[model samples]
Target: MSKPPSPILDLSHTGLLIAAHGSPSTKGGRTSSRKHAETIRNLGLFADVRAGFLTEKPFIKDVLDGIHLPEVYVVPNLAYRGFVSTTKLPQALNLTGEVTERITPNGHQRVHLCDPVGTDPSTAKTFAVRILSTMDSLKVPDTDTAIVVIGHGSGRGRESFEHTNRIARDLSRFGIIPPVFTTFLEEPPFIKNWRDLTRAKNVIFAPYLISDGFHGSEEVPRDIGFNTKSEIFIERLSHVQPNEMNQDGQRLIYLPPLGDAPEMAELIINRVRASLT
Candidate 1:
């Protein structure tokens, strides 16, 4: 009798680590990280899916140190390539090489650094959909409401702000006729200028961020002259009581962060597969 054929090993079943800037508050504070992992697992894209974070406790290094995988790909859950994507991430992983660095610390496990989720063009399209959907749900007039996408803008690198601007521009094609502008956390046309950027009396504040952490929860509202009660303000404005708007102003609605949309997951998986080839 002929010998039985040996089983084939599928190297594509390598492990995937979805890393993000984690949060300290709430359960599974790494919301985006977990969502990306789940999306990958749900799509049957990878054999193993794990999560890591930069901020908060249990940094990426700590998480990677405990996990065991044949080949690990550190995919940032962030939208753009800023400090986290450049210096902090590489140093945390002990990586020393070029942009697409592949480092094997102690020659044990191989780790590959993949492009951030924001760099992918597909992300722009996904963001467009999220903004429109939020507008629809809030019953805001697409033609009258000004959609503002808030990003963690950087002065050193224009990539993050550029990506955000592209996303806002892309959203215009969706028939939201008023205007789509972008604001930043570190750059000009800051949050304070939000009221002046658009002519729409009703504003929809949508964060172009991945998590509902400090920037989304605290800083954003404080910058706008309100407190952590931003959601309350948004809800109250949705109905637009006659007395709410000041003598020279109109109501403003703040939407939640665009965290781990299904389309975002698709974009990430596609980017990773493309990078591998």
Candidate 2:
């Protein structure tokens, strides 16, 4: 089938810059961001598409300097609209607000700062799609499965925890799957208590994280009794790992972070488009 035309028009000179929170210890986060940027680039909707990181090479400032486009939309690839999206990103890009007009060495450029892609309610739809798809592949009925979304909630503020809980609430409302739960690494009802929190025989762990890195590959698994601290960290080969493990009389299926979802490229585009109007 032919691909649908893009919603926005006349973007021959427009550009997209995905500002991501890079992982210094692992390349997974940077790789995920670049893949999303490439996916959007393939759509032929913009003159340029690039991913820049905060903790890695080709940093945000460098990427911004390299872009010569007259208009660029900066979208935070983070899973939450907390400190990084609201303060760190804008400060790094020298943006004062949603729209910032600045004169760069390359030329005069107009920067449009957009909300983090995770802030989009449709992101919950993406989560639902991923969860249901994984369940179908595993032959695990939704009725018997429990979705536990794990996030790194902060003690400093409620934004991180609230964002994760919101996704859980949204998934619950979808009614496609029963018994969705939320847990955090830094806050109450922590991930270590996942098994005790649900009664389902099959538990699917959806990391509400932008980048899987050490959290998804190691910490979460260890916390949930799937792996030991000494176990080798497995890099994600796909969105859903084919090997499901049996843990304490229950089936455990862990998925890659939300940013790695195939729908993310389109989601980023939508967020950028929304900023235009």
Candidate 3:
């Protein structure tokens, strides 16, 4: 089979805006976004790199208005093209759909909206890397580890689950981790019943979602009995000092969500660049 074309593009003179669905209580949101912005800025690929969010400061319109560049590319820091990416984000940015022309003080700025980070094909590698890196960080062996990819599935929509399935399929084919299984919070194949899904003595449960917010940080842990409550986002992984925790005779590691991780910057950049083509 032929390889796919490179997603990187000549993004010179174009500003990059990473669009994220920020949380009011997520202290890491700004920090993570700033780190990604700095990382992309350090690359010197574009005129500038900034984060514009739907629920936080330096919001989409504000960030868009602040930029003096002639063009800007907005990449959704999302896991899928659900209502957020497809409707809310674009609507917030004043986009008719994909490309929206914004009237800045200097002149009309051309804004190109890229698909969410989760929609990219490269995320599968990111997922694999996240799982492996978590294992390495915790000094856990790769022996009989059931790598569980968790998505913030919707009970009402198929789009989120569909993209998740594709990504999971791609990740499985990569063979980075044997027996890569996928589950969701809202949908079937629930995270609570992961043990029944696979017989691997060890497990690494990873959230396929973008943020370290409520879903990944609180809800997931609560659902999986890793936490007592889902009311607050824990500073790090829930109620564990040793990287790997023993849950019902199974060694499990709960990996952080993709949004807060630094590795996500590469995937964001790729999605932004891919939008140019």
The root-mean-square deviation over C-alpha atoms between each candidate and the true structure, in angstroms, is: 7.4, 2.4, 4.6
Instruction: Quote the RMSD, in angstroms, for model 3.
Output: 4.6
Model 1: per-residue lDDT, tens digit, 35-100? 667766765556677777777666788877665665667777787878888788888878664323
Q: Name the runs in model 3 displaced over 4 angstroms.
A: 1-10, 28-31, 136-143, 228-242
Cα displacement (Å) at residue 146, model 1? 1.1
lDDT of 1: 0.67
Record all residue pairs in model 3 with backbone atoms less than 3 Å apart, i.e. clashing: 210-259
Number of the top lDDT candidate: 2
Q: Report the alpha-carbon TM-score of model 1 versus the true structure.
A: 0.79
Model 2 stretches with alpha carbons more than 4 Å out: 1-5, 28-30, 228-243
lDDT of each: 0.67, 0.80, 0.74
Clashes of 1: 1
**Rank order (by TM-score, best first):** 2, 3, 1
Model 3, 48-94: lDDT tens digits are 78887788787887887788998888888888888888889888888
CA shift at 47, candidate 3, in angstroms? 1.9
Put down candidate 2 lDDT per residue, 1-277, tens digits, no spaces: 0243556667768999999888777664336788888887887888999989887876998898899999999999988889888988888888989999999887899999998999886888888888888777778886787888998898878999988988888886555556888998889889999877896888888889877456766687778876534323253334335235786788887777777776777778888878877
Clashing pairs in 2: none
Alpha-carbon TM-score of each model against the true structure: 0.79, 0.91, 0.85
Which candidate number has the best TM-score?
2
